[model samples]
Target: MGKLTRRADFLAANGGFRAPTPGFVLLVRPRGDDDPAMRLGLTVSKKVGGAVVRNRMKRRFRELARLVLPEAGIAGADHVLIGRQGGIERPFEQLAADLRRAIAKVRK
Candidate 1:
């Protein structure tokens, strides 16, 4: 998973974020010539917890993005994965499915 170094670029160039019903927050940025290798940005707000709790959510987002992004063909696109308020309690499979859907939407 490449890092989402150009955060501002991603936010500016791509489509606005999408919230697909119950499970995920999908931020979609359009493809560009200088785009990194299907990069991902994970943001866990303070509302979730302190550093430890937020870090854990970030870790989960990283793992899932690595596993799913490439397969979804996220080249030239930037995606930021934000954890919901009820994060730890969310089912893993549901999270995965939400990511997959987000990837699909952005790729289109």
Candidate 2:
């Protein structure tokens, strides 16, 4: 898996499929090319809280991505995980499960 670094990549994924879970929103889009890796982006909006809270949510989302993406992610796709208000307080295992479900949903 790789990181989705460019603004265009994020916007493209946002324009694709969206799956909303309790912890976050998952966006996915195919690259439409030969790249075999799945790319990931994270977004934690300021409306969720202040910088500290937003960063904490991002940290949690990053860890969840690392745990779930390798086995569950779709190849040649860009994925963006958008943090929600309850993300910081959600249990790690639950968050992971949410991501798993979100990936499945987006792929379908």
Candidate 3:
């Protein structure tokens, strides 16, 4: 899997970009008045599943972000991906598409 190394680098410096009730674990931060390269954080709640499941979900999110972030061109925003219980059953391709759409919206 590719690495989210650049996104991680950005997040270490920027704080967080937050929105409410994002659909899946691979979406991007919403549009805002910010100017830093986008970074991503992954959050998997315990209520979603057990520790193993949570960890797996987080890994999936991170990996997806790594693959998609470069094309996202979302500069100057902090992004966080929260994993929902539904994500465990959702298809990865759809999740990736959702992420791209989110990034496109936020870039506008």
lDDT of 1 at 80: 76
Superposed Cα deviation of residue 15, candidate 3 (Å): 11
lDDT over C-alpha atoms for residue 48 of model 2: 97
The window of 10 residues in a row where model 1 has the poorest summed lDDT is 13-22
| Pairs of residues clashing in candidate 1 | 14-29, 14-30
lDDT scores in order: 0.70, 0.89, 0.63
- Write the residue-wise lDDT of candidate 2 on 1-108 in tens digits: 789888888888989999999889999899889988888899999989999999889888888888899999988988899988888889999999988988898877
- Candidate 1, 1-108: lDDT as tens digits: 566666576566346656453544778765567746666777778988888888888888777877777787456766777777776668777788877876676556
How well does candidate 2 score on lDDT at residue 104?
91
Sequence-dependent TM-score of model 1: 0.79
Flag regions of model 1 displaced more than 4 Å. Answer: 13-17, 34-36
lDDT of 3 by residue, 1-108 (tens): 212346554454234333333446334443365546565666677889999999888888877878887777466555667787788777788778878776666555
Highest TM-score among the candidates is held by which one? Answer: 2
lDDT of 1 at 23: 41
